[model samples]
Target: MSRERVSFTELTDVSQKYWPEASVGVSLIAPAIYRLHEYLNRLARELFKQYNLQSAEFETLCALRNSPEPYRITPTELYRKLLVSSGGMTKILLRLEDKELIERPANLADARSRLVALTPKGKSLIEKVTAQLIEQEAELVARIDQPGQLEQHLLRWLAQIESHQDDKGPHL
Candidate 1:
């Protein structure tokens, strides 16, 4: 069976009919955000493909790229930040290392662990990809003509969610 794309208005209407007491906030915003997330994920997959990169590899590069200058972090930190298992991080690091996109150097502070550093080539690649990705993402908000306002709203909502999550204790 094919799933037809339903308009937001129709969805809300049908949802209300099914559950008269359904909260509009959940019915509307959750679905809207979910649909947008699906679209963005597809867009990101296509963009990552053009760079011949897997999602985890690209994300690992990003985590390194966004870190303090010299762009290095311990593998443990990388796995924690990415929420992947140690074994998973090892595989990702190995693949990235083969591409010369990252280098693992012995951590002077810790003999037991090595630091993951972004290579100059990796920096260049990530920067190029980020620029293109931002350009493409901008199109999604172009019609809104109030990207800043939208971002502020999202930030507030995110902070609230994060705060609630924090109350539950450490994520991993």
Candidate 2:
């Protein structure tokens, strides 16, 4: 089977015909951003599926594994860090617990909250998966002629966008 490949030129041509008033900047950058987002998402899903993990499950495990000693943290903290709702986090935690990948132990310091820690199995899984993910990411960008320069440019661009977000003005 074969797939048709759409070029950036075609995209710009279509945009130019459909929306003549739009700036060239938007026509180029917007589609590129969307395509990059889609490609990254698909890659992430494939990587997670290889380990039989959903994105949320992998993120939750990563949160616990990246925490301090014993790699434990509160559910509240996890949800906050992940920008997930309390109810949504609870469901993710429940699934992890059911899989024996995490445990909800009594928080000796605070009776109100429970500590979520990775099981040895979970720790091992995260370590292995994380390494694989990093390797895959590196491979994806390896073809770039100047990755460091690209990274610096992206960082500056993203920072500029973030800094201006609160200005309540038009953005490019």
Candidate 3:
């Protein structure tokens, strides 16, 4: 008995409609990764807009909620965690502070340093949004049948890849 060979068409039928003429080598892996990343990021942006927050602001709020002790993190810590430059982090902090969602405190340990923390209202907002975000994420990730396994696999794949880089260099 002989088995038939499967063509690329069979593996990537749906993708061809939009990315027709894509090279076999590039199309197979790169497009899928790009599309999935794009879609998820778009969805996150939409969700953040619903809360009158941008993606960066939402992330900072959530990060504060997850922090140790006083639920505050220094500007340096936040910039490091968010993988943004000091100026970029400053902009985000100013925007969130304008919304009264966070507080800036003079760090006792270092007078020149400032720490950012979520306000009570910020905590409340995150608690509410987190539940909603989790539900949305669950629905999105449910598209993957075995999410736990898929998540693990994706994390391992990402870890094996080089660090995310920008035009400047390897992102911190």
lDDT for each residue of candidate 2 in 49-155, tens digit (9 for 90 to 100) = 88888999999999998899699988889999898999999999998998899999999999998999999999999899889888888888998799999899989
> On a 0 to 1 TM-score scale, where does candidate 2 land against the true structure?
0.84
How many residue pairs clash (N, CA or C atoms closer than 3 angstroms) in each of the candidate models, in the order given? Answer: 0, 0, 0
- Residue 63 C-alpha lDDT in model 1: 96
Quote each prediction's TM-score: 0.85, 0.84, 0.77
**Cα lDDT of model 1 by residue, 1-172, tens digit:** 9687787778778878998677555646767888889888889899999999999998999999989999999998889999999999999999999999999999999898889999999999999998998899998879787889989999999888888886777561
Q: What is the C-alpha lDDT of each candidate?
A: 0.90, 0.87, 0.82
> After TM-score superposition, what is the CA distance of residue 85 in candidate 3 from its true location, in Å?
1.2
Tens-digit lDDT track for model 3 on 31-100? 5676677667877788778889988898889889999857898988988988889999999999999999
Deviation (Å) of 109 in candidate 3: 0.3
Error of 2 at 61 (Å): 1.2
Q: In terms of lDDT, which candidate is strongest? A: 1
Model 3 segments more than 4 A misplaced: 1-22, 162-172
lDDT of 2 at 43: 87
